[model samples]
Target: MTKGRAALLVVAAIVFLTVGFVIGQMVQAAGAIPGTAGDPLVAQSYVEKIVGETVASLQTKLDEMQAKVDDLQEEVDALSGDTGTNKGSGKTTLPQSSNPPAQGKTVVVSGDSANIRTGPGTTYAKVTTLVKGDTATMVSEENGWYKITLQDGKEGWVANWLVEVK
Candidate 1:
């Protein structure tokens, strides 16, 4: 990746971690609510709401940062005359492939119930549920999440803690 892309990725990872930390603190706070010692769902819901809001806030920031990155990429593309070189990364970008299944690697769910989500973060909507022995193809990875292709060929992302590479 280019230095610019790498920097954006670092920022994204930091956002993810910060959100996780905030949710953790919120959960701790919720657990202390009076008369709710026996019911953890309240805490769960609170954490979920916090996560959702944090994700929404970060999404806007990401969009703005992405626009900047896109502008830089466009400038680079123009100067390089649309060549395959990925400037600042010292690497050549590979041409994309048509075959989806054969393109990337695969991984299997290590946990009993793994959530496959619309995006890498837990704040993203859960699109499917995978149990132990479930498998998916690797698509992309950033932060502590894995973007995967389900066995049925649908695309989604999962938390890295839930899976092991196949």
Candidate 2:
């Protein structure tokens, strides 16, 4: 063969081999070798869907917990029996009585059924009846009784033997 033609043929072969090698390297780098094919967009979509579902589930659980907390707060308020205005030490205050007295003390019912009287003595009219564990604020002590206010804000008196100071 002529020298110029031989050199041209060699240069063409080199160019072909270089192009083939670059293509092969690109295919391998893209993970398309053998039986494998990679699609980055499809993998990214699957990961995004999983993260979205997890966030939604966490939000639902947080909402359920907040609802439970609100319910518990309502139950606590009901059990407290608070009138919302008497935040003072769980005690009731009463009007002054007609006899000699002590001031600013707490009194509790001492019997299973203690009479609440309109006045300070046995001869007074019966206003109501209080059971043991019932509490009141003593406005005064008269002759031998304690004048107190009921939970419902009514003023009444009870025999000293039927009530005690605390």
Tens digits of per-residue lDDT, candidate 1, 1-166, equal 6999999999999999999999999998776555343554456556555665665466446546655676677688888797645543422234333433333777888755576778755546668777667888898875567788897889998777767776
lDDT by residue for model 2 over 45-99, one digit each (tens)? Answer: 5655565566546644654664566556556666888565633222223544455
Candidate 2, residue 31: Cα displacement in angstroms equals 86
Instruction: Name the runs in model 1 displaced over 4 angstroms.
Output: 1-103
Cα lDDT of candidate 2 equals 0.68
- lDDT at position 104, candidate 1: 76
Q: Enumerate residue pairs that collide in model 2.
A: none
For model 2, what is the alpha-carbon lDDT of residue 107? 81
Q: Least accurate stretch of 10 residues (summed lDDT) in model 2?
A: 86-95
